[model samples]
Target: MSKELLMKVLNHEDTNGQLPWIPFAGVHAGKLKGYTGKEILTDSAKLIECLREVYRLYQPDGMPIVFDLQIEAEILGCELLWADYNPPSVVSHLFDKEKGIPCKCKFPTAESGRIPIVLEAMRVMKEEVGDQTALYGLICGPLTLASHLRGSEFFKDVNKNPDYVVQLTSFCAEYAQKMADLYIEAGMDVIAVVDPLVSQISPKSFSKLLHEPFKAVFDYIRMKGVKSSFFVCGNASYQIKVMCETYPDSMAVDENVDMVAAKVITDQYNIALSGNIPLTTTMLFGTQQDNMKGVLDLIDSIDNKKNLIISPGCDMPYDVPPENTVACAMAVHRPDEVRSMIANYSSSGFDDIEITIPDYASRDKVYIELFTLDPEQCAACTYMVKSVTDIYDEIKDMADYVVYKYFIKEDIARTAKMGLKNLPTMCIDGESVYISIIPDSDELITEVTKRYNKKHDK
Candidate 1:
């Protein structure tokens, strides 16, 4: 029938047993082109080029315009801590910590920071590949946006201040709908409400505080005659039934939720199912042979892929080897070849991947090890390493630190040895203090002093 890839998978009417594969690589595509996160995200031409490269490489049935959840948060006054390989992480919430209240902020508009960049990128991408492949307009889900704006306080507020959270969530949903309108106009065929935080709360809490707001977002997308999907990565098994009932055309979950089990749940509801490829262990670090094995395993686990879209569990890390992703696509399109490769493939050994934990009590000065993926390419690592430097003048007497450069690409052995899961991890006295998140200067200093004081007190 030569139907569009996404629609074929969404309806599952007759793909002729050809399961659609979607690779969740967005800004990470910039890495393949030697462009850093900052350069590509800021320049629409570069961003479009990155997307084009991804389309040419992976040839996904559907692809997200952006894998970043920080765009809407950025427009709403939440400051992002930018990185080289991955999307920016929200650092400063739009709330007054001292006052313990939500800070007043202006609503974001089309002219807001980077919204135009995103919308422009989508328009440009559609002109290039819209008719052939499904272009996804990714938006931050309401609870996630609220969390970005209000920080963890948003979670606490759900309990202590349900009314306040209800109001904030409503605003986020409306904001998402506005972005949805812009995306639909820009030629996006799908609206994915990406909300990873939803996994942290209970079903009861979700039903009480979040269900209606989320339902509204899906309802709005339906009114636009576009597909709406709820993307909740993490173990969100409890909400699968609720999500199917929430009115989204489909639901995508991460590897934490078993795809086979998820399929069983979604099957009963008759909604579409997608996602489950492991990002780090199998996708980023695994070899092509491993890729085939993992893909085959995922394919076997699902009862049926009729309405299922095979995809990575989460955003493919910025440095995920291109070959691994290509292998995944190969597993889908060239299964005979993959079967042959799997027959000859041998397992890799990591028997020596271990680093001795430092004894903080034995050291005179507190030791901090900052693991990074090339400061030359990664702004997040650059700033994180600098976070220590800026305070070194004051804490030098109490602490010492070192940096592991190109930690993901060149130093895979060391990365594995450190047991580091996220980039720019801050290890203090052999204990990881922060993963991906750059702690505030004051907070970092206080911990340093406290460690020093503990040494003297003993």
Candidate 2:
């Protein structure tokens, strides 16, 4: 019945019905059952056990089969750096922008790399929860998979050779289709193209480079009689309208976007929408009351609650308290009761914390600061950091360059101090040079060189 409610909401059929709650449990499912990220992701039995635990605890209306974006990348030959807590990060790429697609890289088969493990898990979960909860099969988005295959040079190709990017992304879309087909066969109710990288580019770039490829994947999913969702993780407010134009059944966003405003755009196309809960501030660090109040406030803020599904900004962190998630579920299930419980409740705000910022003009050395959500876990941040690092050897001595990762509590405060709004930003002397979008190597070098010359009067 809950799964039917969710599917009805996704299809925009039940306007007056209950709003679904999808936890995006991903690797966080493992944390619920005393399993590590590496353990549950690699083991089918463990993965199943963990997911069962999640269903028991959260009572989610929907849940993703697996949250790891690197499944396809790993199969296509990208090496990964596995972690105990979070999903694994891709550590190597198979293709280079200048060299073109690697001839040795072939399409992934159902027998290839971890697909067997995932398919096995999917088959079981469909049987276990298919009656009550909508199951999501998340495929790495076209641009993100292209970045995994082509490395940081993928962005360079976007500016210097768009035709190449189109070719690469088109190829990636085929892989996405294949992955989607596999999940559909394995009994996925919803096929989500998890392309966090799209949040980094402009709407124009998205249209020029990714429009058809994305549309193709979603269109194919539609033809298969399965619902589709386009999920992006960063501050993608700028691309919402264009994203809706691709015509996925739904669009899911992270904490960075304003749900009300995004919903206005999504509603224009009659696409159902999900998400915008703050992952760190509310889910991970805040109390149960905080979670409840956040959900209630979100529910209240949206004038049209018809097509909205409340979820964490992105993947749930590994350590989010089970009770906090329950609070969200409670608010969704029992809003009036929750409202009275939190009638006078207020969350402790971090706005009072002091943050020291860099003195760009007074410093003698050119300061190059890179802000990210940890380069290790986020692919967009990884490649954004890579764009600078790839050119570091060439500009190391030419300028006083330093890269700082603002992923921790203190650094998050510092990010606020620097007036940076987006993750994976490149700042030259405290000025935001690249926001979300990765810069070309030559552009980065030239900007750094100009800044260095101005600093030393060279």
Candidate 3:
């Protein structure tokens, strides 16, 4: 709860103890105690009640006081569309030139917006939990705050108005300091700057527009003598190097980025690394055996430097059965028992790597399965599937290959079984051939024919 526990590990000091597990549950906890969305978020008493339940149920060593990223935006004049289960989404951007009312978009103060409500909640929670659990204050990152202020234009401004974007982000950095001050004052031990949008920009653009502003925030937090972490969701594979350079106490990545790659970068910086328990498949939908197997595999993959902390990739999804999280915790506390349960998992996701094809000495057909998030709804998925269909039709009669396309959301077990991570993946003969990129007609034909020709080998 203090610098001696999670903070010591994050600060890279000699803790000589186990690292903590902090799943970003936030509003998701409302599901456990049956509190409506507004009540859970707005009522301090309800917030306290939720905290007790979380500690009792999950026993997370560290937890966030509130994960509502919209507080700053709302204070700046943006409207929010609340959900019953999850935190509200920004319905209006306050600084977009065309859609935003620019005059209303200004920097917020401690007294502005829901800041008072949040500070009060933190104050109450801190008194309630005291030092028994580490408390985190998740301030919206500059890039993500810019997205709330300016909407999608924030992404474009990185290239279109890089200088202006930098200035605006600097303004966000100040707000981050204000929020951190309030949280620290309320007894928060960690200030996590959660900027889930940083991965959306090119690495070069991230350096130009985001790196400095983020450093300014981290530096300010360091001067305050509190622990800090940078949470970037999505495939931040491009921004990983630049992320470490910004000098956070720790860098928390998501499931989209492989822990192996994340470990290499975080180790170089000598910072603690946290994340990415499989949010949907392993934690929400999968069985205890599944969580144990996946969590153990993830735990074994990273270095035993005490830097790796296991947690869900992003905010824990609502409706995620408590049993799954308990299973995750079991993996932490009872590794031997959990490891033994691995043999019981039937729907082993990546065990498909051992997929063996029966001797195809005489078979004349190539079996292909196209995996997508949602081909009908996702534009890229739809296009990728179309490209495959177009080429397959051209050589369907000449080459005996059959394809079946499916949406990942429609089946988690199926998606996991294929060991597919990226969207718009095409698996031919038990191996992913094309991933995230649509293939050229010639290239597609060559690969398909190569497989089909092997079938007819005399």
Candidate 4:
């Protein structure tokens, strides 16, 4: 089938358009609006506002009403550690070794933690952009929700007390189905089950512990006559064939799996496949031209658009810029335009610039060195390098350390020799220390001081 026919099937519309476009703009939306993942998720009004901005900017064919996977877990008693730039991490699993497992896990009510926030956001999005965009309602899949509530124990439990694990997953499935029903009633076009943790489990355990529960969830959505999508993140290549066996109308995966292979499996099963983009490198950090080129490459590689959705591999980082996402959306809708833009673009003022740091070893003072890409070009890299510089300046004389910065573009051999993975890394005495994100000032000082003392003592 052509891309148009695939889109028609997705929207249940007349068969006359291209394949559906879905941008998994999770926490990235928060980043665009300068809000933390926790704040954006916990406040319905904020989430709606941010998404409204996204809708206005991207004009996507479909979008998830709430991109968070921890909502259901939060309601089930998991304590979340909220962050300013990223999604809140599940800090405390209620069923950990210290907490002990409960006899029964009950279904959560609508008023439970974060549930009401998500539902309200969905309602607002329905009222606002419901006519044009296919709003998706993302709920934690049974296995993932169980993992958040029980941590790694959920995996161990699958092997030890298989029956109890079945019961727990069954409860989670019902919870997910209930959440799906609520979102569907609120005007969501698709129900997406996000179970990233399942990538870690064996197919045997997944089949035994999760397969039935997943079937139950999908069956409930099928009964409602709504489309259901299964989303997984992480390296799940081994589970791809089995995931197709679950029979979701659509499946979305992250960059860890090969898209071509996933496409083959999904096509064989007649299930739609979406995504496989690198969220961290491509969406969060890459340039607009880079994003366009990457998307076009993927599009050219795929022979079948009959069941495909274009999207980022997983939840976006909170700091991902809005313009990059807009660039992606534009590329998806207008490949010709992207190509033209790339061709016509000229190097900006900061291009091809070389930066260097003066020798610090000859000086009598202790010295701190921060290596980064040009700050004027990369905001994230700039901030990270500045963070290290600021800490060194604050405690310079007292700690006997001088601070210096070196741009990566001018020092490729040095960067490569340090064996760094990402940009804006910190190095103390030629030893690469921190990666992309900046570390706390005091903590960095303490670490540097310890290293300095050890060197002097030796």
Candidate 5:
């Protein structure tokens, strides 16, 4: 069946409508408008403007209003280190910093931190696009939100002190219900409960710790007469069958789980299944042709229209090129267009070109190799390159320094030779010390200084 017909069946609408393609645009929307993830989320105007641009480009059937999971934790006093290419990861957990997990967790009001910003954005989006599009209000699920508040301790709490963990998760559930109510009032059509961390726990643990809170949140959303979806990212294959029993209107899984397998499980429960496409590998790193083919492969694999919703496996990378996402959306809406694109598609290195790094040992000066796929297009690569460049500027004159930026696509051999596992890595004198995470500037300086001093001593 066609994507449009499939979407209609999933939405419980007439068969004449087209399939609903919802791309989890998340932090990528921030990059589209030249704002960092933190800036885009914390400011209502920026978030609205960014999402409007996303709507114009993707023409999605449904779109998430706000995708930041840190809103609740930020309001609860957890510190975050914002990224230009990704949603800010929770850096400091409040419960960890405080003496202990509070007996009673207080729910955050709309006036708290970024909550007002998200709500305002939702309201504006509803007024502007509600007629044509289904607006999704994304909230971190109780288990995941509790994890953010208490850190890994929450996981241990589940293993060690089950009763207290249950209380904490219940508190998070109440907060989610309140947030869902607020979003329903703002005209959201769907409330998505995203608890990716649940994948880490065993099914027994999930049942004991999350089942009640999960049911409460979904039940509350249903009571309010709004639709609900549960989104989980990571290796959730083990929990897919059990997750279906939660009775969400829809369940979204990431690339780690097989869609064909998920369809069978979700079908048993008669729940809608969305996703399993590799966002990082196919959408973020792969070409438009790659995305089109990948999505088509997934669509062809699923059996029933009522049991499927085509989408990215998880939230898109912040710097994923807009063209790729637009291509994926178009492919989902118009399979004929996808067929045409695939027929004429050529395997050209348009974006995946590589760069060559000169041998620093052969040269007299110190060498700084900034290995990247494409700093201009890749957010993580851009920051990694910048962090090294900034450090270079601080100590360039002090040493005979040479900085070269290498793109992996153009120089696969160099990348492999360096034994680099992640993109946007830094190499000093052919030794790779920094991996995926951004290294501290002072640390980089110290390492560079040591390298220079060691060379002089030799």
Candidate 6:
């Protein structure tokens, strides 16, 4: 019943007016079974255990086999920094502007890196849950894969060296197609190009650089007779129309994009819509009542439930209370029952969680604080942090820099105290300077320098 209903929604068909649900479990699945992300992601047995626990607890209509985007990068020769909670981050790149991409750098085969491990897990999960659940095979998007191979220089090359950027992203698109083929062979019901970085660029940049690569990979997936989805995180509302032009079977945006507004563009192309559940404020920090209310509210906001799949904005965090997710599942499955269960729900009661912000005027050095949803796991947060890291050496003498991860309960409280409205924001002297967008090195240095000079009265 779950698989059939999910396929109907993914296929943009009538699901008897029932909206499907897919929680991007990812590494968070490991937490349910008492396994660390590093332990479960590497060991098939542990990964399976965690996934089974998720199925038992959440009863998701669809779920990804593995959500780590670093798999392809690790295979392609990038060094990774592993974590116990979050997915690994690429610590080293294959190439940069100073050193061009090596001739030896080529596409990965099915046997490369951890593909065998992931494929083995995928095959088994298909047999374990495929009868009732839709298994999603998530492949890294071209822009993100390019960032892995070329480091942060990939973003700067958009303006400096367009031709080189094209060549690299073209190669990445080919890699994505091959990955889709492997996932299809392993019996994946859907192939999602999980490219969170798409939210950072402008619509014009996407049209000029990424349009063809995205279209090519999605076209390949469609030809293979597999349902496809374009999954993006951060605030991607601005480029929703351009993203639709690529023509995926469905489009999933995170909590940042308005679902009502996004549904209009996706519906224009007859594509199904999924997501916009707040991961931090609601899922991680908010109570179970808040989670139930969120799911119910999202369901109420959408008049057309024909092509909607209720889900979190992005991947669920490591310690997002299982009861909260259970609450979400109950709301999605039995909205009326859950609605009565939490009719008078209020998100208050955090009044006692005190957070004292720093005094900007009294500080001798210019202060720069980066607020993120853990850069290690989030593509947008990774580059936004790198934007500051790229210029840190020059500003070290005059500016004090720190990163505040929203995953921590303390940081979540700090967000409310500091009046932060967005994740992965850069604040200078307690003021939000850059929102979701990553600033270029030159501009970052200039801003820090101006602040430092003002503080010194020079």
**Number of the predicted model whose lDDT against the real structure is largest:** 6
Question: Which ten residues in a row are the worst by lDDT in model 3?
Answer: 401-410
lDDT of 5 by residue, 1-458 (tens): 13244335455554432456888888789888898877887788999999999899988878898787777777777887776666776667778534255434456667767778888999999898787878889998998778777765554577677887888788889888878877888889889998776665677888767788898898899889877899986557778776767778899987657778878887888788888666655786678898888877788777565556778876777767899998888778898778877985654433444546566666555677766544443333444555565456687854443333332234544666567754455677777765443464666678777877777774
The candidates, ranked best first by TM-score, are: 2, 6, 1, 3, 5, 4
- Candidate 4 Cα errors over 4 Å, as ranges: 1-17, 98-105, 343-458
Cα lDDT tens digits, model 2, 195-245, are 999988889999987999999999999999999999997789999999998
Candidates ranked by lDDT: 6, 2, 1, 5, 3, 4
lDDT string for model 4 (266-384, tens) is 78988888886666556655687777777877777787766777888766655566777777777778877778778755323223444454454554445555555333222233345
The estimated TM-scores of all candidates read 0.78, 0.96, 0.77, 0.73, 0.74, 0.95
Q: After superposition, how far is residue 92 of candidate 6 from its true place, in Å?
A: 0.5
State which candidate, 5 or 6, has the greater TM-score.
Answer: 6
> Model 1 over residues 57-111: C-alpha lDDT tens digits?
9977888888778888787777888777667887787773521323335555668
- Model 1 CA deviation exceeding 4 Å by range: 1-3, 96-107, 344-346, 349-351, 355-458
lDDT of each candidate versus the true structure: 0.77, 0.86, 0.72, 0.69, 0.72, 0.87
Best model per TM-score: 2
Spell out the clash pairs found in candidate 1. Answer: none
**After superposing candidate 3, which stretches have Cα over 4 Å from the reference?**
1-3, 14-17, 98-106, 341-420, 423-458
CA lDDT for candidate 6: 0.87
Q: Where in model 5 is the C-alpha error above 4 Å? A: 1-18, 97-105, 344-458
Tens digits of per-residue lDDT for model 3 on 1-458? 33246666786766553556786778778878898656778877787788778877887768887877788888887898777766777767777665232332355555777777777778887787756777888999987787778765554566667777887788888878878888888788889999866765577877877889899999999999988999876567778899988899888877778888888888888888889886776777687778778878887786564676777777776667888888887786567787877765666453333333433344567766666543432233444555566566876854443333331234544666566776556777767886654454566777877887777772
Cα displacement (Å) at residue 65, model 2: 0.9
Per-model C-alpha RMSD: 5.7, 1.8, 8.3, 9.0, 8.3, 1.8
- Lowest summed-lDDT stretch of 10 residues in model 2? 96-105
